[model samples]
Target chain A: MSQFLDISGLNARIDADGQEKEILRGVDLVIPPGEVHAIMGPNGSGKSTLSYVLAGREDYEVTSGSVSFQGKDLLEMEPEERAAAGLFLAFQSPVELPGVNNANFLRTAVNAVRRARGQEELDAVNFLKTVRAAAKELGMSPDMLKRNVNVGFSGGEKKRNEVLQMTLLQPSFAILDETDSGLDVDALRIVAEGVKRLRSPQFSALVITHHQRLLEYIVPDRIHVMAKGRIIHSGGPELAQQIDREGYTKFLAEAA
Target chain B: MSAPLAVTLEPFRKQLEGVSGQPQKTALEALHHTGLPDRRVEDWKYTSLRFLAGSVFHKPGKNYDSAKARAALAALGLAEGAVAELPRLVFVNGHFVADLSVTKGLFACSFYTADKAEPGSLVRSDREPLAALNTVLAENGVVISVPEGIDAGQVLLVSLGQADSDAVSYHPRHSVHVAKGGKLSLLSVQAGEGHYLHNPVTEVFVAAEAELRHVTLQAESDAAANLSTLYAQIEERGNYDSFVVGIGAALSRHEVHACLAESFAQVHINGVQRLAQTQHGDITSVITHAAPDCISRQTVRNVLDDRARGVFQGKVLVEQIAQKTDGYQMNQALLLSGQAEIDAKPQLEIYADDVKCSHGATVGALDDDQLFYMRSRGVPEGEARQILIDAFLEEVLELIGDETAREVCKTVIARRFPVSEEGA
Candidate 1:
C-alpha cells in the first residue's frame, strides 16, 4: 500500500545572507495512514525546517530528493495547493495579520480549500454558525472570531487559533510545530484533544515538539529522534519518555 | 519666475483676460507673480504642474453631453441607491445642472456664479498658487449653509468632468457654513472621463459647537490632472472631520489648510491614496492649532503599484498660545512593485510649552510572513495579497464616520483596485 506521507533522501538548504546553509540533509521519514508520529530534537536540528519544507514554504530550496503525499509529488505543488490537498501546518509562531478579521480570514481560507476540493463554499451565515461551534469546542470566545487575526492574542490563544483553523480546514495530514511550547496544561490538553478528535483511519499527524508532556496527552504511535538535519533513530511511543529522561545526548552519541 | 514658468501660466493667463472681479484680479496678479509652481517651489516641491505647460485648457462650454453626465452619475450609483435620495448638487463640467440636482429643505443651498465670485477670507491666494489659480478661474459653485442647532443629515456634491477631444479646465469654488450647534455631512465625489484639469477650491466654516463631517472621493480620469485645494476654519468646540480617498488621475494633488481658531476645537485631515501604473497622487495639508487646548489629527496611507508614485506632505503647526494642545500625525506607504515610489514628509512645528505632539512615517512592502500565512491556509496568492492590501487600508477606512460616505469610498476603491484578480 502507498504511504500517507513519504520523504526520502530529502535535502533542503536556505540562502542566508551570502551563504547557503543546509537545514535538511538526506532525511528520510514515512508515516502510514491512521497513525500519529512525533519528532523531538535539540535546537538547530531542522525540525521546523522539515515541517516548512513539507508545507511548501518558498524560502527553502529543495536541492534533492522528493516528498510524496498520497503518492503525489508534494514538493511540486504550491503552498495553497498543498493546503487544498489536505495538508496543514500549525506554525510555531503564528503570523499576526492586523486589520484582517479572524472570521473573514477563516471563511476565505475554508472556502478556498473547499472550492479546490470540489465542495460547496460556505456563505457568511453558515460559516459563522460553523465557526462559532468550532471555536466553542476549542474553548475560545466568540469574540475572537471578530478581532483581527492573532493580533494581540496571547501565545496560548494563538495556539488554539491554529487548532481552530486545523479543525475547520479538516486536513488529512497536519504538522504541529511546537504548538504546546507556550501553551498551559489546559491549552495543551485542548490542543492535543483537537488532534485526537480528528484521528481516523485516514488522518495522520507529525507532531514536532521538545517535551514529552504533550506526548502524554495524545501519545504518538512512533517517535523519531532528529539531529543535525537528519532523523538518526526511531522507536515506539515509549521512546518519548526515554528521551525525556535521558535527553538526546545519548541518541546523538550513539548515532555518531 | 522663469520664462518657462510664464509659458505654463500663459493658458490660464489668457483665461484671466476680460474678467473683472476684485478677487479675480488679485488672484490673477498673484498667479502672474508666482506663475504655476514647479519642482523648485518648496510647497510644490514634489509635485509638478509642468503637465499644464503649453497646454491650452479652455473653459468648459455649454452643450456638453447631458447623457454622458447622467451616465457618470449612474456610475456612482447616485441614480438609484441610498445616495440618490440625498440632496445632491450636480455639476457637469463646471456648470451646475439644476435639472440633475435635487435640493431639499433641510439645508439652504445656493449656486454662486463666477461673475459674483467672492473669495472667502480663509484662503491665502498670494501664498498658494493653486488657490490663486482656482480663485482666478472659478466659474460657479454651491453654497451650503446649515442653520444653528439644526442637523442637516447628509448632502452629495458630485462633479463629473466629460471632456471629449478638447482638454478643458473647470474651476469650481465651493463653500460650507454650519451655525453654532448645527451638524452636516458632505460627501464630495470627483469622477469623469477623458483628459482635463479639475481645479476646485472649497472653503468651510465650522461655527462654535457645530460639527461638519466631510469626505471627498477623487477618482478622476486616467488622463486627467486634479489639483484641488480646501481651506477650513474651526471655531470654539467645533469639529471639522474630513477624509479624502484618491484613486484616479494621471496626476493629482489634494491640498488642505485647516485652522483650529478657538479653544477645544478639533480638526482631522485623514486620507488614503491608491495609485497604479504611472499615476501620481499627492496629499498635502497644513493644519494650524492657534488656540489653547485644541486638537489635530492626521493620518495618510498610500498604496502604490507598478510605476505609480505617491506624495504625502503634512505640516502641523501649534502656536505659542496653543498650550495644552494635542496633535498626532502618521503617514504610511506600501509599495507593491520595486519601481513604485512614495515620498512622505511629516512636519510638526510646535511653539507651545505644554503640548503632546507625535509624528511617524513608515514605508514598506507587503509582509511576506503574513502573505505566506494566508496562502498556506488555502487562499490563492493573488487573493492573499489583495486581502493584505485591504487590511492595510482598513484601519484608516474605518475612521470615516458617515456610513453612506464610507461605503461609497469602499465601493469606489474596491472597484478601482479589485479584491482579487484571476492572475494578479
Candidate 2:
C-alpha cells in the first residue's frame, strides 16, 4: 500500500554564523507499517540532524525535501501539530522544563494530542492510572511524576522518561535519538523492552544510535549506515553485525 | 516650601486642623516640612509624585453605602468562597462601614481610630512624608492586638477605595500587635474604583517569641494611585511573615520597613507585583537587622505586560550589634512584551563582620527554550506562554509559609492572566 513514512531526496542545511552548512543531503528513506529501522553512524555524520528535521525544529532550512507521514505533509506541520499527528521524537537530551510538574506536562500534552485526533481527553484519575502503570513497567519511580519534568533527573532516568512518554503517547511513528547512550545495561534492556512492546501492525520506529548493543535487545529489521551527511549503505540486520565487527571505516571511505 | 505645594496642601491642612491628637499635630507639622515626597528624595527615587503634585486631591469626606461596599467585596470573589467565612473589617472610602463588617464576637478591634482616638503610633512620619499625611488625615483604621499567651483567630481587612467623588484621597492607618507568646494571621486586601489616591499606613509590633502572618493583596484601578507603607518592629525570638501581591493601579507602591530589633528575630517578605498597559507598580522594602542572630529573607517577582513598568528597590541594613545575621534578597522580573520595562535596585548596608548577606536581581523575557519545550509537547503556544509565566511567578508564591493565603494569591494571579488554563 502507501509508505508509512516517506522521506525522498531530503536535503537540509543549518545556518551557522554566516554560512549554510549542509547536514542532510538528498537522503531517501521509506518504511511500511510495522517495520523498525536503525541508523548507525559515526560522529559528525548527519544521523541526529535527520531526526531533528523530522521533528520540525526551528533554524534548520529544508532546502529540498519531502517528509510524508501517513500520506500527509509532515514538514509543513508545527512541532506541536506534528506531535498531534501521531509523530513523536524522543530527544537525544530530553528537555528539562523547570517549574512544570512532570505529570502536569504530560497530561497537558496527552490531552492536546488526544483532542487533535478527535478523541476524548483522559481525566486526571485515568491519566494517573495509565501513567503509573507505564512508569512501573519502565522501572521509573512514581515520584518522578511529582517533580519538575526532566529537572535534576539522572542520565538514565531521563532516558527512561523518554520511553515512559513514548509508552504514554502511543505514537504510531517514533524517532529515538541516542536513547541508550546514557543508559546502563539494565536500563537499556528496560527501555528496549518498552519499545519492543509497541511493535505492532501500525507501529514503526527509527532508532538513531552509534552502538549496536541496543540493536541486540530490540533487533531492527533494517540497519542503515550513514556517513558525510548521507545514508550511503543499506542492508539487513546482518549488516549491523558486519559494522560492529569492522566499524564504519568501509562506509566512510566509500562515501568520500 | 513652594507656593504651588502650599496651595495643594491647603485643603488637607484644613481637614487635619479639625483633628486634635498630639501625633496628628506632629505628623501634620512634618507634612508641612517635607511636603509630599517628590522625585528628589532617595527613598522615592524611582517613583515621582510630580503628577499628583498638580492635582488637588481632597481628603475623602465621601460617604460609604454599605450596599456598595458589600458589592465591592463580593466582586473580589473573595466573599464567594473560602474568604467568605472570614470575619472581615470593611472600609469604604476611608470610612468603616459597621453594617458591612462582622466585628462583635469573633475578634475585637482594640482601637477604632474612626471616632477620633488611638493614634496608632505614627512611627515613620519623620522619614516618610506619605506617613505624615496618613497620621494627619486618616479617617478610619483597625488596630487588632492579641494579648499574651493567646492564639487569636485570623482577621480579614478589606479596604475599598471606591467613591463617587472626583480625585479623592484616603489615608487609612492600621496597627496590629501580637504580645509575647501570642499568634495572629492577618489577610489585608486593598482595591479601588475610579480615579483616587489611597495612602494607607500599617504598623505591626511583634513582642518577644510571638508570631504574625501578614498577606496583603493590592488591586487598584488604572485611574488610581496607591502608596501604602508598612512599618514593623519585632522583638527577640519574634517571627514576622509578610507577602504582598499587587495588580492594577496606574501608579502603586508598597513600601515596607521591617526591623528585627532583637536577637533571634526572623522576617520574611515575599511578594509579586504585576502590571499591564502603561500601569506602574513598585515593591520597595527596607529591612534592618538591629540585633544579633537574626534572619531575613526577601523574594519578589514582577510580571509586566504591554508598556507597564515595574520597580523593585530593596535594601538590607545590618547593624554592628547584628553579628551572626543572615540575610537574602532576590528580585526577578518577566517582561512578556518588548515595550515592558523593569527597574531593580538591591542594596546591602552591613556593619557586622560575622554576617552573611547576599542580594541578586534578574530581568528577562519568558525563556524561549522553555516556551518551545512546552509547545513542542503539544501545548498551544498561548497556553505554553501562560504556563511558563505562571511558573516564573510561582517560585515566589511557593515560598509563602501559609497555605490558604498562598492559594488565594495563586487564584488571583491566574484569574488576571487570560491564557491561564487554571482560571480559563
Candidate 3:
C-alpha cells in the first residue's frame, strides 16, 4: 500500500540579497495513514519552509525533492489541486480576508472541493447544518461565522477557524504548521480536541511545532528532532518528553 | 481673468435665448452672461467641456414615432405588453414619448410639460443653468413628485435611446420632488442600443421630514457616450440615499452632488463602476454641509479589467456654520490586469470647529495571500481572482437597500469579469 504522504530528499533554499541560503537539506519523512508524527525543531530549522513547499506557495523554490500524496505527485499539482486531493495545511498565521464572510468562504471552499471530486454541491440548509455542528464542537460562536474571515479576530479565534476549515474539508492528510503558537491553554485544548475528533484510520497528520505543549494534547505516536536543515533524531513519544525536559541546548551544540 | 468667462458666455447666451419659458429663459440668459464654467469652476476642472467648443448640436425635434419608441423599449427587456407594474417613462433620443409614459396621481408628465403646466410653482421656476441647458436642448424629460404627507410607491423611470439614421445627441432632464413627511423610491434605468450621445440631468428636492431613495443603473451600448449629473438638496429632518451602478460605455461620466441645506439632514451615496477593454468610466461626487447637525457617507468602488480605465473623485465639504457635521468617504478600486488603471481621489475639507470628517482611497490588485488561500481551497486561479474581485465590489453593492437592484448590479459586474477569458 502507498504511504499517505511521502517526502524524500526534500531540499529548499532562500535567496536573500543575491546570496543563496540553504534551508531544508535532504529532509526525508514518511507519514503512513492513521499515524500522527511530530517534528520538533529550533528556529531556522525550515519547519515553516517545509509547510510552504508542501502547500505550493510561489516564493519557496524546492531545490531537489519528491513529494507524493496518496500515490500522486503532490509537488506537481497546484495548491488548490492539492487541497482537492485531501491534503490540508493549517497555516501558522491564518490569513485575514476582509469583506469575505467566514461562513460563505468555508461553504465555497467545501463546494469547490466537492465539485472537483465529481460531487454535487451542498445546499444552504445542509451546509449550515454541517458547519454549525463543527463550530459548536470547536467552541466557535455563530456570530463568528457571520463575520469576515479572520478579520479583527483574536489569535485564538484564527486558530479555531483553521480547525473549522479542517473539520469542514475533512482532508486525508493535514499539516499543522505551529498552530499552537499563540493559543492559550484552553484554546490549545479545544484545537487538540477538534483534531482528536477527526482522527481515523484513513486520516493522518504531521504536526510541526517548536514546543512539546501541543504534542501533549494531540499525543503524537512518534517524535523527530530537526536541526541544521535536516532531521537528526527520531524516536517514540518519549523523545518529546526528553526534549521538554532538556530543551534544544544539546541539539544546538551538536548542530553547530 | 474674466476674459475666459466672457468667451465662455457667448454660446450659453445664445442657447439661453432658445429656452422657451420666459422666466426660466431670462434666468438662464442672466447666468450665461455670468460665463460658462471653466477650469476656474471648482467642479469643472477634471471634466472640461471645451471639447464642445466648435460643435453645434441641433435641438431635437418631436418627430419620434410611438412604434419606434415601443420597439426601443422592447429591446431593453421593457416590453410594452409585459405585466410588470413599473411606472415606465420612455425617452426617444432624449425626448419623452407620452404614449409610452405612465403617469398617475403624484407622478406627473415630463419636466418640460410639467413646467408648462405649473409655470409659477416654486419647484418648476427654480432651475440651474445646466438644468436650463438640458431644458432647452432636451427633447423630453420626466418628473416624479410625491405630495406632502403622502408616500410615493416605487417609481421606475426608463430612458429609452432611439437613434435615427442621422447620429443624434440627447439631453434628458428629470426632477423629483418629495414633500414634507413623504417617502419616495425611484429606480432610473438608462438603456439603449444606439450610437447616440445621452446627457442627462436629474435634480431632487427633499423637503423637511421627508425620505428619498434613488437608484440609477446605466447600461448604454459600447459605442455610445453617456454623461449623467444628479443634484439634490436636503431640508431639515430629511433623509436622502442615492446609488449609481454603471457597466461602462465608450465614455461614461456620472456626477452626484448633494447639499445638506438644513439642520438634521442626512445623505448617503454609494456607486460602482465596471469597465473592460478601452472603456472609460468616471464617478465624481460632492457633498456639502451648509447647516449644523448634518451627516454624510459616501462609498465608491470601481473594477477595471483589461485595458479599461476608471476614475473616482469624491469630496465632502463642511462650512463653519455646519457644526456637528459628520462625513466619511471611502473609494476603492480593483485593477484586475496590469494594463488596467484607476485614478481615485477622496477629499475632505472642513472649516467647522466641531465636525468629524475622514476620507480614504485605495487602488490595488487582488491580495496575493487571499488568492493563494482561495486557490488552496480547490478553486481555479481564474475563479479565485474573480471571487476576490466580486467581494471587493460587493462593499458598494451591499449599500443598495433593494435586493433586486443589488442582484442586477452583481450580475452586470460578473459579466465584466469572465473567468474563461483572459484580459477581459
Give model 2's TM-score for chain A to 2 decimal places: 0.98
- lDDT per residue (tens digit) for residues B1-424 in model 3: 1223356545333333435656455545554555545667665555555544444334456677677667655544454322235666667677766677766543544365535623223222133344444544554577777889988767767776655554456777677889998898777777675566678877788999999988888877776778787788999999998898888467777877789999999999888888888888888887899999998988888888788878888888899999999888888888878999887777788899999888888888888888887777777777777777777778778899866556555655565445752212
Clashing pairs in 2: none
lDDT of each: 0.91, 0.84, 0.78
lDDT of 1 at A123: 93
Q: Output the number of the TM-score-best candidate.
A: 1
Q: Which of the CAPRI classes, incorrect, acceptable, medium or high, describes model 1?
A: high
Q: What is the TM-score of each candidate's chain B when compared with the real chain B? A: 0.97, 0.93, 0.83
Per residue, candidate 2 scores C-alpha lDDT tens digits across A38-105 of 99999988998898889878878999978899999989998888888877888898888778899998
Clashing residue pairs for model 3 = B95-B140
How many clashes in candidate 1? Answer: 0
What is every candidate's C-alpha DockQ against the true complex, given to 2 decimals?
0.91, 0.62, 0.60
Taking all chains together, the TM-score of candidate 2 against the true structure is 0.93
Q: For every candidate structure, what is the RMSD over all alpha carbons to the true structure, in angstroms?
A: 1.7, 2.8, 4.5
lDDT of 3 by residue, A91-199 (tens): 9989888778899989989998999888899999999999999999999999999999999999999999999999999888889999999999999999999999889
State which candidate has the highest lDDT. 1
Residues B1-424, model 1: lDDT tens digits? 2223356677665576676788988887788787788888888888888777767788888666878888888776667667878988888888898888888744898877878777788878998888898888887899999999999999999998888887889998999999999999999999999989999999999999999999999999999999999999999999999999999999999999999999999999999999999999999999999999999998889999999999999999999999999999999999999999998888889898999999999999998889889989999998999999999998999999998898888888887887655634
Which 10 consecutive residues of model 2 chain A have the lowest summed lDDT? A78-87
